[model samples]
Target chain A: EAGVTQFPSHSVIEKGQTVTLRCDPISGHDNLYWYRRVMGKEIKFLLHFVKESKQDESGMPNNRFLAERTGGTYSTLKVQPAELEDSGVYFCASSQMRTGELFFGEGSRLTVL
Target chain B: ELKVEQNPLFLSMQEGKNYTIYCNYSTTSDRLYWYRQDPGKSLESLFVLLSNGAVKQEGRLMASLDTKARLSTLHITAAVHDLSATYFCAVGSNSGGGADGLTFGKGTHLIIQP
Candidate 1:
């Protein structure tokens, strides 16, 4: 089975610009997650989606960050007017509901200058 | 707030040596996980400890959890050069059967040289 896949493995944008990262999860997986690692720090959770509904999004940084999972097959994280601190690797993970194991994607590296 | 802390953020040892990485969390959680990640790679699940006193072993790595202490340990036995990678432990936010996100540690970067 294919693991979680993310698009635009690397992205470079100027501050105040917008970038969107996409993640395609494994088939039939009901749980999807978004996490980020900044400046070689710890990986932090951003949000989670169960099917098409957002289970929890408390980890999102601010209003400038928006994540959506329409129809539940994939997810998109959009950062508007990105700041320098937004430069990091964004990882997407998926798993079956009630199963603690998570399969992660290759990650989308964003560089905001 | 949930927080996870890992100790010995960096480990450098010779092959055949043994070392243990520790993970401690601030909240009460029964589900803990260990993951391995190579440079510029995605996270690979290593072990999942579901309950108190749970222990799981694979190959040269073993992970054990103590819910009462909110601590988990990853023990590497007779480590080889191939075992060099960053190891992370995460605690599930929801103690019950919920698909909540995890709180992860800063990761233990292990390097085993010959």
Candidate 2:
């Protein structure tokens, strides 16, 4: 089975610009999560979605970042007016509701110059 | 807030040597997970310790958890060059389900040389 897949493996944008990253989870998976790693530091949790519903978004850094899972299949994370500190790899993970073994995707590397 | 800390953030060892990486969390958690990541690669699930005294082993790596101490250890046995990668330990906020976000430690970067 195909694991989680993310789009725009790498994205470069100027400061104050906007970028959207997409993730496609494995089929029938009910849970999707977003995490970010900055400057080779610890990977921090961002948010989680359970079948199109936002279960916990407490990890969202700020209002500038928005994540959505419209139909419960794929999810998107959008950063508006990206800042220099936003340059890092954003990883998307998925798992079943009952089983918590998360499967991660090749991260979307964002560079804000 | 839950916090996870990993010690020996960087390690360089020769082949056939053995080393252990430690993970400690500040708060009580229900599950702990170990992951491996090579340079520029995605996080790969290594082991998941669900309860206290849980131990899981695969190949040269073994991971164990002690809930009472809020500590987990990843032991590498007879390390090889292929074992060089960054290892991370994460704690889940809730119990057995996939409803919570994980708090992760700064990864331990391991280098096993020949």
In order, how many clashes per candidate?
Answer: 0, 0
Estimated TM-score per prediction?
0.96, 0.96
Docking tier of model 1: it is medium
- Interface DockQ per candidate: 0.65, 0.63
Off by over 4 Å in 1: B95-99
User: Tens digit of lDDT per residue, candidate 2, span B18-105?
Assistant: 9999999987788899999999888999998899999999999999999999999999999999999999999986543433789999
lDDT of 1 at A105: 98
Q: Model 2 scores what on Cα lDDT?
A: 0.92
- Each model's lDDT comes to 0.91, 0.92
Could you tell me which residue pairs clash in candidate 2?
Answer: none
